[model samples]
Target chain A: MLKLPSVPGGAPPRPGTPAAEPASLKDNASEAAISALGWLDERTAISGTARWVMFRKVPKGTNWFYTLGTSTMMAFLSQVVTGVFLAMYYDPSPNNAYESMRHINNDVFLGQFVHGMHRWGATTMVVLIFLHMGRTFFFGAYKYPRELNWVIGVILVLLTMIMALTGYLLPWDQRSYWATAVGVNVFASAPIAGPYLGDFLRAGPEFGATTLSRFYAIHMLLLPGLIGGLIAAHLYLVIKHGTTAPPWIEAEIDEDLRKSEA
Target chain B: MPDTSKNTSPYTADRNIPGAFEGETVTRRRFMTGAAHATNGIAVGMIALPAIGFALGPNFKKLEERWEAVGRPDEFSPTEYISRTITVVAGAGETGKTTVYLRERNPDIDHEPEDEYNQYIAISTRCMHLGCPVRYVPASQRFICPCHGGVYDFLGEVQGGPPVRPLDRFYTRVKDGLVELGPRFSVNSELKRFSPRDPAQDLDALGQYLFPSRPTIRKIPGT
Candidate 1:
């Protein structure tokens, strides 16, 4: 990263803007500030174009309702950071899986907590994404042009679930074993290709070390990469769709009726 | 579909646009479409997730379990069976002290159950895949590994799973009234019958008799 020059006193770099004699420099700074603010302003307002859809300012205005998308993004970023840490200690093998995990708990500092957080946070992403989608749906946000974005969001959720499932097997212990067996059983219940699917997935007779390594790759790399792409697309769509009108529209209608009484 | 296009009234359908006439409904349509697709996309994405996970891994950790020894009897249990596991201390090998299970439960046969006049066939719990301990699963009637899903029966035969072959079984004999297991031996079977460490099929009769599983492709007689 190229570090920008800053005042020694610790401030944003304000080199040429003078206190009194400045004219063009002041104009330049003001122009820079105004343009920054203008970009923010342009992304708001109820009516926006496909060319540039203003999202924050809608008929309803930014309220508690607008936080869901940002919240989902926050959780995803947290996963990336914590997942990176967990990758440091997680061993992807079936035999020494439980022993390695125990070693992490007993030997490595803060390893247990990081592992727990990654485990629990993935679960929370499932919940939060559902809630976010629900919030978007009942509001009739996906009726027309937003359909593709809705699909992308769904893909994101599925990717997250895949990531979580793959992570589940990396521990390589008995719990990982049986859970995977149940998973394979579910797969075996699928249409015609069940048995072949199970064998192919396991890469052998049963879910063992080979299966663990495969899942670890998918969890730590494959699904996560897909998720990253989908999230980026999802955000792009969010910027395009803009916010929906709030429930307060009905409240406003009610307030107007009461105002006549007053 | 109820003639969706005709549902719009003529007044709404015809737009008098000279030059600057936007569809007006286009943004609304786009927004709604985007949301709809996102919702649908997520549903499909979520659906693929379980499928992807199962394909990637159907881990057996849950099916596996931990094995804990309740305790050994003062005397070897009658072994109408061929296999029995006895714990040997790291240092006790030199003393030739091994616990053996009697093949038949006979109270009147010879002294008490504690005497050193019995034989027990015992297999180690270690998994062949990673050397992790295997557990005795009576319900499944196989010695299952909690670490991996390796399965073994009473005869210490590795039935299936990732294990290369049957687990190592230590032959036990009571010598001088002290239950003593063998110096560690694995026996391969080509001929039928409960045979001891046969010199013919022994991979390492002197090293540590390790056995190999014979595939059914070439059916050798006896075993």
Candidate 2:
């Protein structure tokens, strides 16, 4: 019989050593949870995958600036939550738009507070994203293998601005009305397809019901979906490329270790 | 110095530091690369300009405030307040139907022919809190917003609830025996006085605390 290496606590018998009996659960709550995870791992390798993604080692010099990306994500999630709540009471019609906003501000439970949070959260996210981008640029984190991520970041910035613009008209207040009018007219000034594009956005020659509905759809649905995809791609690239180190520390590291693989 | 000779892998060792490569001077190549990037950036921006302009076209349009004729002077009663719906042309050719509360102020004082305009008090039916229409309650001599229970006395003063200021008033003019409504003036919450100028300009002291200014386009003569 082939003599296998001695197990830690099992007896190493002479030629006919039978395999040691499998260990049973320790009859404790913690042991039960561990055993349950072990059972899951046997089928799906869940623990291994979790360890690979969640517990992977980051570079030594990663600092507080690294948290900006997570902060932007948190801000986005807050927007989504607050937006959904507002959407519940929001009337996407020209007739009811102002009234519905009034209802939300005055009547809905914590409505004004949540609405304020969403508005401020959007502004915060925009600021945080730019700061995050600035950090990445200064640290030279967008070099070589992460160039695509930089491109994606630019796209994200544009998408965020679009999100803001589309949402600006939702309240249908005087400010929103005039602001949206000015915003759409800027699009109409484009050289060749400007008129067509303006018509498409406005849904008519003038600002009316269709314009409100279209902006509402774009703000609530289309932009969010596109941004959600971009965010996923951005995060995937971050994980694959690994977080970049600070410039000073990166200069000291070995060249081979410094250049992350694509 | 670290041993440079041992680090022979072209992909890993050469491209580690940004713009650093083996056997080439960094400055010239770096400049060329930067120029190329700048050129590409300009090209992308040029392409994006029209699309961005198209997206933000509404923002560029001029906002205009036009005086709309609501009703004749005789239609309003001297004894009680009456609510009348009038279409107001807002920015970009969009019209909003708003309620105007019309009542003859100081019915006891005989009005002179020229001062007929001063006899009428035209308060916006829209609540000061969030723009919900306030209904005039003759029983309690108050205007109440059904949406929020905000009470405004017959003069459009906020008697109770979350209204920061009294209801906004229309800049009214009596022309050809008709009440013509011009732009709205915002009321100072503390002073209880309406600022005749644009709210944005008048409430500069509040600094964005009051309603945002709806700047009307200053129409120039003959293009």
Candidate 3:
């Protein structure tokens, strides 16, 4: 029941006239795109979901600050893409890890660029996620019915920190090695369960052969799956309960309702 | 309506279900559901338990006690320290190796009780604060940690900084004309030897009981 926009003053020719009229290339392209989308929508019956997700009724006074969550997601997506490529060349063994990184920097095409994106994107994601958290806090969006979402957000922040910590050791250079040593020792500094937890993280009492591989598995496989699942839940809750307007936006009183109450 | 609340009898037939056997206690449907749940639980446990054990098995595994000979006894002096690279973990190339400062035991300065393992003193470079490698500077006669500001004097006791205890030491013995370093052992403020603990785990008072030694690495028995 959908109609395409008609060409201005370009009505169909009479049946008796020559059938040489051609549709515009733009019109043909749009028609093909729309038909492809329509065919997919028919088989999947997904138009309703698409409309529901895309055409959300955001609150009044939604501003640029609301985009911080999306920005953070973009940063996370960059990290995921670049991390996948980096893992293709990275060696997780203690002996070859540093050498493989040097190879990535020197030999692989656009390796340093992608590696830099992942490195800097990690920082960007942390910054943007915190900024998004700040926006939610300052705007009082974490109150009332959205408290579960806030808790989930806090957990996501923790998982992000775990991602950062685990990813830092994958390079296996001297800085990464010593930094992880210090970091794991920090874990061991705890009173009761510290030593066991350190062993778990390092896969042994000392930073043995398996530590880099363990960190790689944690960083890429375990954490990404957890973060992806949590992000889906986060967006679901966000869509379920629409965003809050800025606190400065007072509720507008309806004159007719006021008169009726009076 | 029937008084179903009163139907607490053990037999299913007493509940008056259609086609219920006379002596049947549980219905086939309930039994099947319970069996299905039990089977699912066993299946899940079969996969999950082994996977968890694979990751955590190293924590409970005891490491092999290794003693590597650093050098001859004449190479070490009591006044100054000599560095020797020793392998703590096997199979790992450079990461497994750590530098130990070795010197002959000075009778006046070394006050710990003399034993078969104390002929030469071997000090672990691992800082007591957060496990960063501390470098011994001959100029100041002080061990300085580059990561943190932990400082230790010639005796490897905490002099000034954030180190919780003294630098850890290795058990040493003279065997076949070569000075060999044995298993690592941690010390308290009084330099009393306990089991080998990770750096930053204090051994003073309740600190020993609080941060217990791992089963993977330990000091020699009766030491």
Candidate 4:
């Protein structure tokens, strides 16, 4: 039997403390399950890692604002789910792109709803991320050891914008066409290397099959892959450094440190 | 004795603190380490520059508009409006087919007309609300957007339902007997002229306040 330390201030156990009872069937089953987990944990160290990351103590005074990051993460996951569903029916060719969108919008079961969710979810993610960033800035959580995480976050913001821009062109509507045209033209205005760079992006000299293909590839594969890797890095950093305390809490800590030294 | 050494409490004084891993010592090794990090950063940035430039190249090129011939003026009937699809090759090498709504007006009823060339008015089929293709309903004499309930009159004026302004029109000209269509220009709300105005701009000040304008092509960059 394992022994536990006595409580600091507690009444002494009665003189006739009851002897330990034998394990019942239910208790045996639970013990067996715990031992199985222990066997796995011995090899994988899963329990220790989970305790270290998941159960780490965060500073007090965190409010609902902290939830924005999780909300953004959920929104991004929804985008990935809906985006995959969309890719199953969406044809990347300019010729069939609009027609496929029409078919999805009007024909497929719950297609319009899913598309709407993805669209609204993208906007929600953008807004939530911005709010999250604002909260971080206001709390000065991006200072000191968290600076690299902030830089990663800025990269994420840029990637999200690029994802939105690339996704906008998939509909092949007049708005998308003209908007993409103008968007690409803006890149062409870059000084000496502008024309060459613009041509490469368009996949030639203009927005055609190549442009659609490139944008589709970037939207569906490249940007998502990059964002996923960056998100992993961001989360790792967050866990590694731990969350920054609110300004008041930090100030209190500072005061305590100065007082103790004095 | 209690196994205090096994306890990994976060409240312990020697717990890891962020940015405090490096000892408080200024040495040649630290300077060299910082310089190495800076060099690695510059190397990574140099590699990233060409990749980003290549990926974003399309945004740098200017696209010129091209005109496409739809049909001869005589081919379209004066009695009823007809919609024709014309494939226009625009900027770089992008080709798209746009629906052009053509109707010949009676010269007798024209006290002041917008199209003086051949009494032919070519309106775009794209809805002003969200760019869904609006279908022409002859019985109701209105262009009805199926996506939403947006309705436009025969003159392309917004009669009801979510449309902010009239449908966009194509710059049409009659050369010889063929009707040549230019790039699309949205209609002005107050003047009813073909201009590069966004329908969002036509919203009342209060409406604008209620409905914020999204990033659109109408807002020119840098100004």
Query: Please, what is the whole-model Cα lDDT of each candidate in the order they appear?
Result: 0.55, 0.70, 0.90, 0.71
Q: Clashing pairs in model 3?
A: none
Candidate order (lDDT): 3, 4, 2, 1
lDDT of 4 by residue, B59-92 (tens): 4433445567778878776556798887544432
Model 2's alpha-carbon lDDT is: 0.70
- Per residue, candidate 1 scores C-alpha lDDT tens digits across A1-262 of 2233322354444577566764576666765665555555456642344346433456655567567877877888888898898777766665456777887778889988887787788778888888888888877676678899888887887777767667777666556655665565455433334434555555533344566677777777788788888887877777766656754465355788788988
TM-score per prediction, in order, is 0.46, 0.50, 0.93, 0.53
Show where candidate 1 strays beyond 4 Å: A1-55, A61-63, A246-262, B1-223
Looking at model 1, residue B49 earns an lDDT score of 90
Look at candidate 2 and tell me the lDDT of residue B24. Answer: 50
Q: What is the DockQ of each candidate?
A: 0.03, 0.03, 0.76, 0.06
Query: How far does residue B118 in candidate 4 sit from its true spot (Å)?
Result: 22
The DockQ-based CAPRI class assigned to model 2 is: incorrect
Q: List model 1 lDDT by residue over B1-223, tens digit each.
A: 2333544533322333223134443344566999999999999999999887766443221122112232344544553433344433222121112232223334553232332222344555545444445776656657777755777665556687765446554434444545454433333321122222211122333222132221111111242
Go through the candidates in order and give the clash count of each: 60, 19, 0, 11
True contacts kept of each: 0.01, 0.00, 0.78, 0.09
Shift in Å, residue B168, candidate 3: 0.7
